[model samples]
Target: MDPHNRRRHPTTTRLPYSLGCHACRRMKVKVLYPRPHYRHSLIGSRQCDEEKPQCVRCTKGGRMCPGYRDANQVVFRSVNTEFIPEAQNSHLRKTSKSGGLLIESISSTPLLTQPTERWEAKAIGHFLYNYSLAPTKDSPGYLGFLSDLLSKEPSNRQLKSGVLAAGYASLANITGLSHLKRSAEKHYGETLQSISMALTDPAEASSDTSLTAIILLQMYEVCYLREMWQSFHNDHSQAISDITLVPQDPHDKGLVELHRLRGNSPSRTAAADGILHIIHGRLHFNSVGGLHPSRIDAELAFEGLNISSSQDELWCIMREMSESCGKIRAIMSDPRRNMPESAIIQSFDRIFAAYLHLLRWEATQSLTRSYQSYKMFSREENDTHQETFPYKYHLFKHIAHGAMWIGFWCTTIYALQTLTRTSSLLDVQLLSRGWHQWDFNKRLRDAIGEICACVPYMMGDVDQLGLPMVGKEGKAIGSFFLLRGLYVAICVEELTDLQSSYILKTLLRIAHVRGIKLALRPRSRWFAQHGIAT
Candidate 1:
């Protein structure tokens, strides 16, 4: 048979019809019969060339030939004759919709797929549990609104990712564990990636979920990273601007209220409607005799108030003052806003009156008595007394004192800034005139002392109160109180350079121990601006 001369046949075809040869019959194929070359073979041989339907010799021998099998028929070979049972093989079978067989191996499953989800759940769980504790007295609505966001379904991926990142970051702080810290970093990267994708879709970018995610990411930076705080600050400022352009939603009302109450610039629509309108309308550009009407009203509202005063009422007053101070600071810092001399004087007087109001409120017998009582409580409890007296009681007492201290400190700073911004002769003369014989230095020293008192209570070191030892707390301090205390310490003028440096360093150390990144930004700013060495 010539190899090149063998024609390719269709897969369905077989050799031409021929009588079966014994070999071809057994093989189920047509036998080839070619004319024998007498010179290439023995004349008596019965074997034909077997190249086609029948060889001439086969015909001469009167033998039948078998047909060839089609090309498409395929045979599979097994390595071993002992086959696995179908029951066992069922595990490898993937059922097809058409009732056909499909096979997949168990090894194809990814090893980390399940663990990744578990890690994500863990991080999210940590966030849900601790996020409520993050806000201060001034922003009580923060956690509530965040909780509301989390309750809704088809959860926002960006927001969830951001929360996970923050949660892991907080866990890193709580435990100081390296793996948790790495997880925080990993989730943070994921959050950024998600946010970047969300931003590409204008609708998603402006969604409430996106805004909340942005806020959470900022919070994470504020909690764990000192160096990133400024960047978060800048990013938040930009987000505030961007949020204004987004279409308003009813659900966003809480956010709007929070922004207004926190003294941040609220959306114009929010500012013009509801209780916000009433508050803004009442406070805007309204003053009398160098005092804000609201401040005067706040004072008058609390006339004859004592230590028995409703804690809620006192808190509300303090919050108002805080907001007012924030507004004043914002206005003073704005280069584009020019105020008339009369307005400036009024601003100065308003701040001065606010400070005085805080002092008067504090001077009440009830307040003084409460302060004394807290001091005694803190003093009575030492590290050894932990079994009998829980640290929470002491923490609560410290927080109460811290709240008052913060109120007074903020009011005083606002007054000081008012004077600094104006630097007017009237402002100078008003203070020099010795109105009620007020001593600014003494007042600042008293405020610093009050703040310093909180340290021992927080550190479980009440026994060393009168001693000059710097103590670290055995447990985490409330970030809110720590931040407020830091703010007061930084802004007050009475502390000597050495005293200020020590306080700042101790505060930073406590913050680090507690995983409090929020205070670091302002604290760092204070050091840089004042050229305070730490």
Candidate 2:
């Protein structure tokens, strides 16, 4: 019964054979039984019975059997020869009579194939389609720069793993696939490990590939990980801080060099800045109750860029907003630190300037403005949207224009809120003399109305005018943008009770439909108008 010294046996039954068990294959031990017509006979192979549980030979010899490889391991190519690019196919033999080639799929050799699993492929594909760069630069989701870098450095395991992790995590959120979620967590852990290992080496850690991987991991966190968001945010900020503080050789740019490594496209650079700012702008302010250090870095990053498009202008407004916020936070937090009314007035003036800029900016985009218009439904015309979407319904030329418009209104409201906060510190008569001409309350209400008007369009629901809404390729991208604006609108004190309730309801619908779990849990302040606390 010794497996190492098996004797040959003769069998007449023409039972088909397969590849051997792990142990047998490793030891070069084959089935002692003979089959003259075996598939692998040309390679002088012996038969593997591949019995259930453990194979008979391994059991008889007290050897542990890992079992045979699954049938999936050995794939057969179709005899019908349709040529495809980058595909492995069988050899062809030319026929003398017809001059046609015949596929020789009868060979025993296995062709090399893509090693990724089916779910992994699906997750990666979904992530790329939504986030990758569009043909035009105006597209909202602009993570395509990561793909460009990935193409160049195919050997960067950490970057690739992080991309897959983000993909898997995002797909899992959308589909509620338990196995995909588990796989996402697995890849996420591996990505973190890879990043950790890479971080130990200064050159590798500062490389563009490494930074891209970290940013991808951050995307996974922002989209899905609610509980870990704060902790991870702090850790990520600290990591960047540590890297930035590293003493650079006089000849080396260090932090500046790391920024340069982000790639050549301004939109790519701006996208990265916008993402970081969003993570900081949204989460950190809630958790830490102050301006995040990374927000400062984002602003500094913005300073280096030249504005070429509306997308760049949007980032510029955001940068200006962040700067205003920092000044207000500093002034309000420390009354004794300075005694300059002019400085405080200047902060207020800057905010109003940014507000004016946003207004002018939108006004100047005549084409985008023409395509995007709003209609307020009357009581007689109101139907189901009467309660769910009682506000205006917006129409757009392109999804990008709609997003920009929503972003504009959201920034307008943000500016109004910031101005109010800043105005509280100074004497009302001092600034209100000139600024009071602009109906701040009406402006606030109008901005909120515009955001509400656009939600149905953004969410792919039909407008009040009976026009079909365009569903963009990445619903998640639209969801994120709407969530940001709506979250702000619902909390505005100027919003009516009915409007606030409708916005909350829309937020809930987005959570269920878009699968962004964060949307489900609104902050306690969001429900104040309903007299309900979190």
Give the top-scoring candidate (lDDT): 2
Q: Indicate the worst ten consecutive residues by lDDT in candidate 2.
A: 285-294
The prediction achieving the highest TM-score against the true structure is 2
Evaluated at residue 248, the lDDT of candidate 1 is 22
Tens-digit lDDT track of model 1 for 221-240: 75666444344345655433
How high is each candidate's TM-score?
Answer: 0.47, 0.61
> What's every prediction's RMSD, in angstroms?
24.0, 15.5
How far off is model 2, as Cα RMSD?
15.5
Residue 375 accuracy (lDDT) in model 1: 36
Candidate 1 is scored at a TM of 0.47
lDDT of 2 by residue, 379-424 (tens): 5654554454555677765455566566667667767766766666
User: What range of 10 consecutive residues in model 1 has the weakest lDDT sum?
Assistant: 284-293
